[model samples]
Target: MSDPSTASIVSTPRAEQPTETVSPVGAPQGDRKEKPRGLLGDAWLDLRRKPLFWISALFILLFLLMAAFPQLFTSGDAVNGSLDRSLGKPSGDAWFGYDFQGRDVYARVIYGARASIVVSVLSVLGTLLVGGAMGVIAGYRGGWVDAVLSRVADVFFGLPFVLGAIVILTTFNGSGTSNSQWKIMGLVTVSLIVLSWPVVMRLMRSSVLSTKEADYIVAARALGAGTGRIVLKHLLPNCLAPLLVYGTIMVGSFIGAEATLSFLGVGLKSPVVSWGIMISESQSFIRVSPSLLFFPSLFLVLAVLSFVMLGEAVREALDPKLR
Candidate 1:
């Protein structure tokens, strides 16, 4: 016979005893916090903590504002300059001084943002649309489709970027038609897009190949989802991170390429103020007015650097291996 207290304790129902708090998966609910879901959610959480990401993002926003509204940055005329003030030294009112035409270098630099930013952005978007589509189709339907697309991409990838651009632009620009700024912009945009998309296509193809085999994709297909549904609903989201990272880096490259083409006289010509045009036009007067070259070059370098930094930050954030 046991004591009454011992008997009562022993007689207590097993269900009434205190048990460790268990999660739905049967793991002890200790100090672990719930992690973020999805690629973008995790990347965003990490990006928010990175100072470099914020700084680069802020710079990009400022550049966009300058591109959209040049008037806000400067009231002076970008084109109209006094010959007398040509190569003028920096004054109280004009921080960047004057160009060879005596136009305000500061104003031109501010206005130049529009062309470079617009061209780069448009080219990247074009690349994404054309290249991304091809990549997805090839990746999702392997075999002969992949072979044909891969071969075509390889052909384009073999072309020399600058030389090819020069040939294309010269052919179009010398057709005896009126070379308006808009027309010139279109030609440059087309040339860049044609030459630049191969890289994106290859990246997307590789990413899709690795992602399509994922369990979720397989399950989605098993659940009677159509081809388009599985590709769009399941695969695209997984592949987008790499594309985004590549596109961000490619923006800076496109900007630099545009500048290179412009410097070679095949890019944006006069009347459309671009940093490239400014650099090319000022090379002759580099000895007399170094500021003309200095200011545009500085702005271009800063813009490219900012985009590259932002891309690297995003890549780091998105890579699970980094964590």
Candidate 2:
């Protein structure tokens, strides 16, 4: 027995060595840190791990912010009607200078982003919905349905989109008011949807055709799954990856088409600021006021290039072969 004066010095159980904590060696790290499981999750993981993805994301976000807040970055009115200081060069006050109408180049470019993004996004959606539906039907049915749809797509693809848009706009030319801009945008969007869906349709049809022949599809069919049920439950889900990749690439193309049509005076009528309008305006003052040409063109190029780069990154990220 210890002496009465000597108190017991029992050591506390070493703080119980936290079971929740993880060591770098091989121990569990906070409940196994559940890994993300879906396509979006995988894409996010890939994006975070990739330098190109982050760089592309950053640039795109910067442009989007600029587009959203033109007033924050520039002076001189974007939509000022009167030509008070037309063709002004870059100054401390006016960052990107003024255009032929004294409207701020920076402001117009920023505003143009709205039009570009809207058109691109809508066109992509339209293409996916129309084309994807048609492709799925045609590929799965593969009878007269496929024949009729294929012929229809071929006919539209053969017709020149730019020329068709020009003709449409020429026939429906408005007084170039605010209302006219909306009408022009609608027409352009329709024209693009008509012509653009074929490529996506082709892609979707091919993808569905291949997917429908897979072992899983056969197994589903043998399990008494009807055509509608099989397609809804299985085929469509498998086709999502390719559709997404194609849709991403098509956004850039649609933007380019919109810009082209606007430049030709067949899209985005007056009162609607756009890159096409900027280029069209610059045609007159190309010799004297090159800023009109340079800044808008630069933004357009940047927009297109950024989307293209982003599409490439997305494709790589989604590609199982790459993984």
Candidate 3:
């Protein structure tokens, strides 16, 4: 009915309206887009999805709870022992059985968690604080300071861990007063800190050196940020991820080191329940009551493995190269 030109114009399809793709829920696709998460956030998201992370985290939490309040785990006395109950099998009250000294092996094992966990945790913290600070300083301000710190680290690194711990602990042992539980723990912690910090220092130093040259750092410098501000605000944050990963793995290593020192008779003394000391005492009874050795060893292995697994999982999550 319309004119030919008018009809042609009407018949021509209008340019397709640029319709936004809608999601199943009828929201625009752009609105459904995910926001970006930074490094730590991304790592956390990844960590949450990993079964290994959850398992390790759960085990570590349980150990921490046990260490902090051992009473929750057991009420039996770890030190008090009855000669009559010596080498007894697992019974009604005693889940792991009596040890060579007739102490409730379960109680001793539970209580022992305190010393080992405390020592490893404290030593690692000390290492991180002292080593991390020194490393940051040296890495940020290279040249003579770095040289001196590097040399000092090398000197400490050259000293064998076990041998150094033995010598240091022997000196403390000679002091006689070091026989106390806290004193023994202190000596062991100090010895470990002295030996262990170099590795953390080197790691942190390397991380810092690499990070200080990043575009953000240069931008901060261009913006007239002071050295202290740049290091504290920017560089340190970047350095922490790798350092934390190392610290986690080192926690397990430190635990093993403490056990080794205790086994060598220079770690925790009598009256201070520890897995290593338990292992040392139970070695002779292995032929008679293998449970004594088996139970504590099992716990130690579990603790170490948990931390190691956690470290590995975190490393995988944080490292883009791994992804």
Per-model TM-score, in order, reads 0.89, 0.83, 0.91
Question: Between the candidate structures 1 and 3, which one is better when assessed by TM-score?
Answer: 3
Compared with the true structure, what per-residue lDDT tens digits does model 3 show for residues 1-323?
Answer: 77999998878775664665546875567546687889999999999999999999999999999899999999999999999998999998999999877899999999999999999999999999999998998999999999999999999999998999899988767643436788888989999999989998999999999999999999999999999899989999899998889999999999999999888888887888899999999889889899999999999999999999999999999998886
Give the Cα error of residue 194 in candidate 1, in Å. Answer: 0.2
lDDT of each: 0.91, 0.81, 0.91
* Candidate 3 vs. true structure, TM-score: 0.91
Q: In model 1, what lDDT does residue 104 have?
A: 93
User: Over the stretch 1-323, how does candidate 1's per-residue lDDT look in tens digits?
Assistant: 77999999989999887987657875766677887588888889999999999999999999999999999999999988899987899997788999878899999999999999999999999999899999999998999999999999999999999989989999888742467888888889999999988888998999999999999988988889999899888889879999899899989888899999999888898888999999999999989889889999999998998999999999999998995
lDDT of 2 by residue, 175-266 (tens): 45546666767777877888888988998999998899999999999999998999889998888888887787787788888889888777
lDDT of 1 at 86: 79
Question: Can you list the residue pairs that collide in candidate 2?
Answer: none
Which pairs clash inside model 3? none
Task: Give the runs in model 1 whose Cα sits over 4 Å from its true position.
Answer: 1-36, 175-177
Clashes of 3: 0
Q: After aligning candidate 1 to the native by TM-score, how far in Å is the CA of 58 from where it should be?
A: 1.4
Looking at model 1, residue 136 earns an lDDT score of 95
